[model samples]
Target: MLDADLKEQLKAYLERVTRPIEITASVDDSAASNELRGLLADLTALSDKITVTERRDDDQRKPSFALTTPGQDISLRFAGIPLGHEFTSLVLALLQVGGHPSKLAADVIEQIRNLDGDFKFETYFSLSCHNCPDVVQALNLMAVLNPRIQHVAIDGALFQSEVDERQVGSVPMIFLNGQMFGAGRMSAEEILAKVDTGASAREAEKLKAKAAFDVLIVGGGPAGAAAAIYAARKGIRTGIAAERFGGQVLDTMGIENFISVKETEGPKMAAALEQHVRQYDVDLMNLQRAEKLVAAGDDGLVEVQLAGGASLKSKTVILSTGARWRQMGVPGENEYRNKGVAYCPHCDGPLFKGKRVAVIGGGNSGVEAAIDLAGIVTHVTLIEFDSKLRADAVLQRKLYSLPNVRVILSALSTEVTGDGQKVNGLTYKDRGTDEQHHVELEGIFVQIGLLPNTEWLKDSGVALSPRGEIIVDDRGQTSLPGVFAAGDVTTVPYKQIVIAMGEGSKAALSAFDHLIRHSAPAESAKAA
Candidate 1:
């Protein structure tokens, strides 16, 4: 069931529907059918425009779902209950089918309308994959607009046999026309580009040529965007290369602690960030991975070499390369990353509701995660390798306040044990006594720490913390004179959205100051 605010939002979004949408389910005596029934009932009760009806079709072979107006057959179908992040997918799909405006670009909708052939998109996704929702929403919107396209978002956990047959290790693995098309989080534009054959192709192509610049930013996240915007405003040639713009923000879910904003989802914030950056002529080259970082030598020009051999050179560089999740380096950890084990509790916790789970690490992140999960999940076991929890006393108190949470200290997470299908439990060791024990649970959240994306600059003489985070001063200046760093990749004490944005602005301003102090007046001035 949706929260009050979310329910209100859904109501407002669905109120414009000029047509009635009936959610039909092929029911049986099974709990799965009942779950489908209950979820649909809650959804239909939201508005008079929506209705639910079920037929006792015990002989049906496939999963059940149908969403169309009464006395109409152009209904959308979902094979399973859209739980976890997929809940968003369900609501968005309803809106789209009920005549809500398409979230895709106008040109994209035109392209979708012109598509030929009966193309089916079978997207294998786990409810926990934060990247899955964007793709699902886009695909569902396209399906709503185009009659030729059929998008089915299947839960990888629910259909483990199909997932194993395809050897799917991660999601959302998208298959088009019954063949694997692509995987992971791709923009709606990119998805259409993959299925198109016209002008859109030329427009959506990844950077074909790299242009020289005065300041080359290595990332397209908040830090890089801030740096580029600041440099561009100074009339300096600025360029940015991002593997994917928005960095970790794309993999995040609900963000309530972003300062002024009351609430916003990750994808919405990411889109807005990109829109703001694009307002300036910051030569944004997305989908470009930075493979090497070269410090300026006698030439006094730094070069950021991308993966495809296109290099962008500039007078200054701001390393905003973000950090990634610190994986539990044990067997089956990688195997079942999205299958049952997850890192972002905010994105995945709802999937394990009424199910037992374990949190590895007793730091603020782990303890906070355990406390949050306690409300949704049946039980949460918090594990820490040290004698005491590293979290603040305040957070520890809040964590201890939860009755469903139990803390275990001096414990080392040994292995994430699971079936070939999905995670079933986890094995940890008593660090003090060297005794190993395994606890049965449906999920494991590894919240040890973040590993910075500064490995490319390791040999470039950038000062890094012992844990590999780029060390920066108060002014965002790195050890190297012309280089600055910000965001989670830097030595910032708290890795947060507002802090990252502020650090990015500081880094950009610092870079600009360096240019004015060291470079020629002609190059420093706007006219130059």
Candidate 2:
């Protein structure tokens, strides 16, 4: 908490040192509108502050104003709550009003600028999503580049009533021109394509698309978000498909070892990344789902059919559609996942230091957890259904070296014996002999493999590996020229957030290459 004298001194110092900035704030009539009014009043009091702009339409409805600033542009929403990383989003809006260039690469800027159309985007997000910040940045850039394009970002927490009113059930939902575009993380290019083509189709009464993007990425996971940012920065108009925005990262309890940023939760990190990528405006679609993806033209144009009877056309597509952790099918599993039964050891291991725990599954994940837990917990009992351990030689040696770790081969978890509140123990059975055993513990770690959320892409023409992963080259390119893949759902071995993000970046860069080459002919023809 800042003292009154300190706050006053800080405000005065800011006022004296900063030059005047042009920005505006608006207020609406509602119970939650006080926040907007207060923010405006505070800014108005400060030098180089946000100005108050109020206007009413003929119907006497208050308008949400777009205020211009030296470094960026801001959209004022009274009675709107910006929660989670949304506070950062608000700051980004101010930055946009201040005219700050986005953190995206130069190439993405060129690609998005070349596309033609008017787009109105509204992205609804919660503070929980790890990738929502990217979604906001993408939409904000669209709002910046084209005045015809309007973007609105709504916070889920502060506006629960409004969220319920809109029937938004999840984090990171985007609505393009009053249509549900899907949720989760989407690239700006994909979003713009949808908007441009949707409008064109509506006007012409047939499927009409003006331009084809080199690659379209779906899902803004570590893989998808990285793909969009890198692709856009490299000058590709990439599009994204998402159900809520952010992807599974948002649900992650905590994240550490993400490279540069050593320790940060999922939401904060996602927000920062999103802010960096929004500069390219790479056609992000939040809360939008693809119903069908069919090949369109010989030029590798793929027609993505959305759920709302709308269609988007793209030359190439990157399938960064990621995977979800397989839930423990036991009755108490859902009730105590984050509470006790954790899937990610890196994220939640520290929380159980010196505690007794058991690791489930027979594969490498389970063995790895047993080894990791041996150091953190008092006793680590590894339960596996297969008769033999599945870990590599080195990992097996490591697990054997740990005295606290014990392996139970041919064992399967029959029930997650818990205290009915949090996880406390587990009951397992031998697969071959039907022998049952019980272990006392404080936590349970489910180390089973994750399930890829690619059921919807069964016929999307993107090739999947035997392990149900989208097969991709080093650059995240799939067997198809236009389609790329990334993340855990892809063939990338490392399932860490950082690895997925890196793959996403690679995919985006590859997409940009495709676009630049495709547009070269058009650019040369125009030059001629």
Candidate 3:
């Protein structure tokens, strides 16, 4: 049975819910002196407990504090933008202030509690980024351990002005005293080392070894992901840098013939593949752009600078930026992308069920889309610029097997016909005989050959084939020293999810080997 006093207190607390209170100047007040007067009045109210202030010191005023109760002031110089990891940190901070102490290791807590000087840390990130969540929690733990350190997060998208002011471009950006730390996901120890300088400069530099791993995998696509997994599982500290978590796999619409999984979507498969690699201690970064690569110290470590100028050093680097669907570059393609024009049949296939659609291109993707669409749609017209379909014989056989599918050989898309709101049909011309025709379609699936996402590596010393694939060895080693390449960006043929995953595992293992070799001297030196 609850005590009478406790029961009454609980009831009172439940009944006292109110808006987060604040005292501010009236909208009509324009003079600076009037605003100052408003501030004085609010402070008086705060002292008397007449009102609770959410924001400390009204906008554009110096901070003035009142600790009526311990940790009760929920104040900020800037309104809580609360985006990305910072949002989670804000919640944690509120929870701590609201009375639930965070559960960090006692040692980590002790280290933070002893800090004496002011430490202001700002993290920049995007909410949509997957890896930002982990790094955000790490920072929150540090904040919980030390009350002297003021932590803040700025949303890269919503707070574009702040981001531009700080020159932030990517998610999971860490800025300590206006100096850029690393980007994407980072460890707590690295951050702590930078702030708490207890070691000698030479020792600190060695301890702050940016890239510990020998091989750095640049993509989380099939090839790169597989490489990282294999290398890290074999006791290598392989690091993978990727713009998005799943890489090209995330864009794939569907996977029907990838060995074990008979039917699956791109994102789902990528997720499963990612989960497989998560068990290892690989430093995987999703939604991070690899900006520049230059050789680091004599240990063969290559420092990779990210979009926000966060540098990481690794001995081996793998370039596995896969290919994307070739765009039509025509007018209506961009305007009605999600409206009616799509790239993946698996992702957008169900939406067009029983509707008429056109499959553009004569390659394997085009043939496969035509075959797949024929079963789901009322009719499927397979359009090809060349006189003959370029797909394999088995896929061509399947295309011919579908009664509702028609093969338009030697035809090119002149223009996509849409009703301004959505796609309606397409106008095409024959390449061989120069004939023009129009066909109504509810959806148009583009299945042309893929284009490599190597625009950034144009001058990065990594050799790209004439077809734009990164030239890599069987073990995912690239042309450049201390750099490896894998997956769709490489010369590997047959762009399939399983193959990419396999390649990723292999690349990871190779990178691990490189890491082991590089760490040997350091471990021996420590022993000595």
Which regions of candidate 2 fall more than 4 Å away from where they truly are? 1-212, 298-300, 328-382, 386-409, 414-427, 437-445, 516-528
**Candidate 3: C-alpha RMSD after superposition:** 13.9
Best candidate according to lDDT: 1
Give the Cα lDDT of each candidate: 0.79, 0.65, 0.64
lDDT of 1: 0.79
Please give, for residues 127-184, the per-residue lDDT of candidate 2 as tens digits: 5455566677777776666555667776555554555456554446677778777665
Give lDDT: candidate 1, residue 127. 73
TM for candidate 3 is 0.55
lDDT of 3 by residue, 72-190 (tens): 33322222233332434434443443345556547556666776677667765554444454556566556545556655554454444565455443456677767886664554544
Candidate 3 lDDT (Cα, 0 to 1): 0.64
Worst 10 residues of 1 by lDDT: 199-208
- Candidate 1 at 159: error in angstroms? 8.7
Q: Tell me the tens digit of each residue's lDDT in model 1 across 219-241.
A: 87777777778888888888887
